[model samples]
Target: MDKYDVVVIGGGPGGYVAAIRAAQLGGKVCVIEKGHLGGTCLNRGCIPSKAIITSMKLLSLIKSSSSFGIDVQGYQINFPKVISRKDEVVLKLRQGIGGLFKAKKIDLKNGDYSNRFRAA
Candidate 1:
């Protein structure tokens, strides 16, 4: 059995950041993440949506270039490619964040803490 000075329930910005801070201060820390790291912000909610929004903005700019006297034509937005790229970006950032946590020596558990730990 292992002991930790702190155990964080979620891996969202708040939880992970707290875990890292505690680890940095020399407290043994463990982060239990029910889903992919970066929580909703990095995985499904914020980062993914932001990536899509940015792609849409870029597409709009390209389409509207002629209005600014810039001759751009025959450009088509490939929806599949856009989605794939967005997924790639999100994955990369997630991995980077996980790496940061690893560098800090924070143990990352791949399941929900509530299910794994029973409150005494």
Candidate 2:
């Protein structure tokens, strides 16, 4: 069994940051993540929401561009494209975190680490 100076339970923002710090401090750090690397915020919450919101904001601006003396003839919202863009954004960010872990020499393990404490 491999051993580590620090084992982070999740790969969320806080957990990943802590693990990276531990590695930077010259400790063997391992992060056990059940889901995607960036956790809820990056995968489903903040990042994804922002992607969709940004598209919507752009659409709104285009619809009102006449006020700005810009001739905007047509505009359409492609739901699939919006979702795909969100997924792409999330994947890029998640990969970035993974890269950081590799560069920092932090071990990343998927799924739960189920070894409970045992009294010797």
lDDT of the candidates, in the order given: 0.88, 0.92
Tell me the lDDT of model 1 at 74. Answer: 88
TM-score per prediction, in order, is 0.92, 0.94
Query: Candidate 1 at 41: error in angstroms?
Result: 1.4
C-alpha-based local distance difference test score of model 1: 0.88
Error of 1 at 58 (Å): 1.0
Query: Whose lDDT is greatest here?
Result: 2
lDDT of 1 by residue, 1-120 (tens): 678889988888999889989999999999888898788888888889999999999988998898999988788989999899989998899888789888999999887457567554
| Candidate 1 stretches greater than 4 Å from native | 118-120
lDDT of 2 by residue, 1-120 (tens): 788889899999999999999999999999999888998999989999999999999999999899999988857889999999999999999999999999999999998667753443
Q: What is the C-alpha RMSD of each candidate to the true structure, in Å?
A: 1.4, 1.5
Stretch of 10 with least lDDT, candidate 2? 111-120
